[model samples]
Target: MSYVKDSDGRWHTIFDQTKGSSCGPTCMRMVVKMMQNRDLGEEQARQLVERKNGVAVLSTLTSENGGVGQMGSHNWGNHGHHASGGGGVGVGAEPLAAALKGTGIKDAHVPQIYARQALLKTSLKNPGIAAVGWGGQWNGKRAQGAHWIVVAGQLSNGNILVFDPIYGIGEIDLSPAIPKYRPANHEATLYNKNVVLTAK
Candidate 1:
């Protein structure tokens, strides 16, 4: 699914990467849309980030029981077969921030927001799009690995307005979203740092 229509009948872009690993770029594209109101497709965002950041952002990443990394080409129990779970692959905070800056977004910064209070405070302070790293479960199913999404803003009740590449626009509570955060990993942490692009 490449898009989902919101209640207002506006079509929001959902970067479906079932065939490839490009969540980082997809989230960046969503940020561009939320911040600058410009639409950049998945491929375009991938190319732009890699080109601008001068680094390769695509790779086969795997996760097992909330763990992320390359552990051979095989899963734990089945050491003879290929890895059958987790497919999140994308850029880290530094590269993502660099890519945004390369696109002329001056307000991009990666902040360490590990708690809901921090996230709320940061979201309130910065009034633009945020590329948030999401893990844990979605739709009653645990995610294979880490994923990236766009945080448009915080609602009055303190829920975040999220624009997921796979789930589209919705609101999620900060409770479940925060604990799954593996702050030790750069790609899985919230915000990857903060990116609040000013209006153009």
Candidate 2:
């Protein structure tokens, strides 16, 4: 994905790649950078990054369930394949919330809270939080590595400074709806062609 500034002075990220291997780290780094600028302590910022990554959480979830799937299930449903897990919708939120519950920031409810906020058209007057999704194709078919992104920030101009795990830090307008699913490898190209966000 490449970050570009449009003529309207808004920064947009284009996902030109077929997979999101680099996307997660890019997004995480962007959020870290943003947090650093916000005066969050180094330990706190590192913890936030760890929660955003969700590797440990995913591992714990998998270990508890003897692997996460029903019978004959190749794909791990919403949790996604273990190798490509942690990038699914809302994956980052629960962990982050758990991490920052006692803190006074009140920003722990990032993933789910932001998702519902966007869906409900609520004002993000407090610390901004966002969730990301992979809405496009992967390898010319559906289910070709679909994923989600989580971003958080106060709104500046008409756009929100975002930390999209599927893309990266940038500004996205408030009119778009978050995607419900991400395509797996070999099934992404035709996964969500021409799908429009009618709400939120």
Candidate 3:
């Protein structure tokens, strides 16, 4: 469930599953389970899960189910058929949002796209605040879709706190690397380091 750097300079994590089930469902289940155990209210749970690492879990869930589907294909009945094509927000975001809402958080289902825009707009209203969306590219081509991230807060040391769903629980210095799915020519990638937030 966590990434570790091995002697081979590669990242690895221990994975567990029952009955060949995918980790996506299991991970979400764990999050929900943890929330219930703590008796966290909906909004509080939403904020907690919206932390840097929580978003990463959400992202993984979406990626595993195929990128979000396009338009009409997003309907549950049509998911499998159009999922392969990829365009709309995948099945993952809404459910996660809904779960957060169930905990009493309203509007938790903010789409990644909307989050990106809101981050930018909100930052513009505050000088010295900024936000950016950073992600690896397939070679020189932009990745098919946005991998949303938020950079917030300035520590006394001048370092920024990054909130990323794809990264883990803590603040990580950003870097770029090729994604697993791209063709070799597209191997050179930008890291998820773009500033999704900045001061106005």
Best by TM-score: 1
RMSD of each: 8.1, 9.8, 11.6
Per residue, candidate 1 scores C-alpha lDDT tens digits across 47-155 of 6666644432332232333221253211122111011234344444556666676666776766554445434543422433344444454445544454555555566
Task: Arrange candidates by TM-score, descending.
Answer: 1, 2, 3
Looking at model 1, report the run of 10 residues with the lowest lDDT sum.
73-82
Q: Could you tell me the TM-score of candidate 3?
A: 0.30
Candidate 2, run of 10 with poorest lDDT: 188-197
Regions of model 3 farther than 4 Å from truth: 1-96, 106-136, 139-142, 148-154, 157-160, 163-165, 169-200
Ranked by TM-score, the better of candidates 1 and 3 is 1
TM-score of 1: 0.59
Worst 10 residues of 3 by lDDT: 123-132
> Over the stretch 1-200, how does candidate 2's per-residue lDDT look in tens digits?
45756434556443321222233223333333333333334334334534444443342212122222243221223344223433332233344444433333344343323343442332222233333333333344332122333333335455444434443344445454542322233211111221111112
**What lDDT score is found at residue 64 in candidate 2?**
22
Cα lDDT tens digits for candidate 3, 11-78: 42322222111222222333343333443333343343334223233343233334222441222222
Model 1 alpha-carbon miss at residue 79, Å: 19
